[model samples]
Target: MAASLIGRHFFIQSRNRRTLTLKSRLKYSSAVQAVSNEDVESLYPPVKPRFPPGNWTSMTEEEAWTRYEAMQEMTAVPTVKERLEKLTKKQMRAYRFPVNNKSVRVLEFQKNVTKSHLIKGLPTVYDSLQVDSLILEKIKPYIIEVLLLEKERLFRSRFRDIHRDSLILRNLIQTLLPLLYEHNTALRTSQVDEEVDIKGFWDRSGFKRVMWYDPEMERPKEFRIKYANDVRFQTAHVCDVSIRTENPLKEFLPIDDELCINEEFPVLEYHPKVFGTSKTDREKSQLTPGYNLGDPCEFGLVSFHNTVWLDYQRRKYGDAVTEEMRQGMGLTASFTWLLAQAYSQGFNSLLDVTYPMTTQTVLSDGQKMSFFAYQLNTIDMLKNNMANPRQNICWYTDETQLYEKIEDGKVIGFNDETCETLLKFLLMKPERRNINMKPTLPAESSDILSETEFISRNPLDLSTETN
Candidate 1:
């Protein structure tokens, strides 16, 4: 039994030894394993080179710099000093007022004259001046018949329906002017200037702004900008249509018209725009009345404003708003136009005009019409200049209905009074101003008007000879 046990032990020991040896052999084989042709081909593709360096240059510093200078000469690069000068000499900024804007409130407010916080009243002109008997009797009936005939023809036309107010106004002018022009010398000689650009800078107690980049200074506690975006600003108005006459209208009031020069009046503190935020502030400066002084038709006889632009106002606020909007339009259009004329004559916000200028204005929207007569008394409304006692004058009439509607070739509610008033406006003759009308232009006139020729000509003379 002992012998058998010893033999079994020896057999088990030998079996364990063989198992350990086999495990060691497998580990050694893995470490020294031979690579096959397939492994060699697939282990990894040969690594591709990237961003290879180019050959180094052997040029000296002087040679490199010379080459650079030559390239710069080819490109014509500016000098450092020239660049610095360009940076230092800042360009003048230009701000502009929109002629027609998206918002009625904005347009009305921007173009508002009465609410400008400027001087209000001047010597009032007699609006109820007697009309000539010839116009009242024979001319009135003829115009009425012509108007009726014209209305009938416009309504029956298939191509143009004449639904828009602008179209109606255009037609009215075309039909009426031709008839009146024959009888009226002023209307015949006076040419129409359409959409003439006028621009200038004047302070009607307008709010001031510090240049955005300017440093704060000791200012009045009340020195606040009218708008957040209100910067150095100016006025630029486009005269839609102006009747340019050969001679200026006679001054409505005598220069020595009695006035308590120190009479005080309340001023309107009104904001020009309702918009809360804006960034544009730079303003463009212009001083032209649509015509140079030497222009034969330099005098403005009448101004026509298209109230059809107020179509949006009527739709939003109802027809009642038309009167209020037009009243402001009449004031604004007349005021700006006269200012432009004054500016062109070398009068500015600082320098007042030597004589007053009278202009007639007609506002229409095809069916409705209103009339105004403006006499520009002063443009010097600056705070310091307000002591000058003269105030501007305006005479205006309410909107008159031309016709209600057209039905089946018969005109509905055709008004004769409106037609007569229109004829009166067209037939209104302009008399030459007996006074030295414009500022005393220098010998070398920017107006192209020779001082000698201007002074030598009689002030009452209607005939104007152009250079």
Candidate 2:
């Protein structure tokens, strides 16, 4: 019986060993399968390369047509008209002011009479006064028309539409601003091709040229630079649209009334010398003292933000004015006037220490227009150049209302101060003290101009040429 029991135990142990061998074989097989699966995944990855680097030939016409037809059936391509509609109407919400031929009023300035005509009652040999007036008058209508048209374009655009919205503003300055020079016989604009590259030209022009002084080197340094990606979008280059006016005023302001406009008033001459180029202070400057002349091309750069945030409010309250809008208009008007002065004086030298010039800025909020005047006393921009430079303009500005509002086309509640400011800027020349004498004259000319230099506080003080 003992022998039988031992034999049975040995049989059980043998069965157990067989079961263990079967389990080990199965485990080995599973491990091999797992490795094979991993290898398969590595060989055929899920991610497809977007641009496969191989010389693959084009598919056959049948395959191509099948794919094209499938795409056409799945989706439709939008029309150009639909795309343009989305861009203009839905994007900008642009509209225009009520303008027509009747909206235009011929602003007549009394034909400027010559001093000789008044004293001797005889026309000079060369009487261009009528021609100048006629030419100047023709440009006024053109200016008004352009301004009205641009306002329509500007007010309609979304500010973020940087390309479409800013295009007209840029065009206004680049294309239209030079039109003012059309009437002036003393000035002529270059016929710059629209397609020409002007980036290099603007970088060095007197107006756009912004520079600094490197104290370490003790020399004036130019910090203006262009990045590789800094490209203007379909905009005319500064050089392409820049108007370079040639003035012989380096020797004189024409004594002949026919050659000059409003000879009774002062004609501001651009100082021939370039200022703000010096590394040293004004007192230590070896160069003749003058204000750095600005380029005519950059003069008309008046920008206004198209505040998307205020659009809802503006729509709710039609023809309403906000503080932000007022501020923007003020800035735009100021820049406009500044450019006007720059363009006017382009033939004359730039402003200088010899004769300081004051210009009035008129800001309109479509409802009401305000006015502010700034006198450029100096352009020694390098005096305190750390990171930012100091503004060289002097403050002679007085807060005044230009018009209460515009009812139809007429100006309502026109402020006398507004009239005076307009007259001073439009009629009276900013720097007219040397109107009679040549700018290069060794002798001193008459000091008939009042001590105030520009517009007065009292509106009644209009007895001067500013009236």
Error of 2 at 66 (Å): 84
Off by over 4 Å in 1: 1-128, 132-171, 181-183, 198-200, 211-240, 255-263, 267-283, 319-321, 443-467
What is the lDDT of every predicted structure here? 0.56, 0.29
TM-scores of all candidate predictions against the true structure: 0.60, 0.25
Q: Kindly list the per-residue Cα lDDT of model 1 for residues 316-335, writing each as its tens digit.
A: 77766554666666776777
Best by lDDT: 1
What ranges in model 2 sit over 4 Å off?
1-169, 173-179, 186-372, 378-467
Question: Which model scores highest in TM-score?
Answer: 1
- Candidate 2 per-residue lDDT, tens place, 8-56, comes to 7768988999999998888877465543454454655677443333221
Error of 2 at 213 (Å): 25
- In candidate 2, what residue range of length 10 has the lowest lDDT sum? 107-116
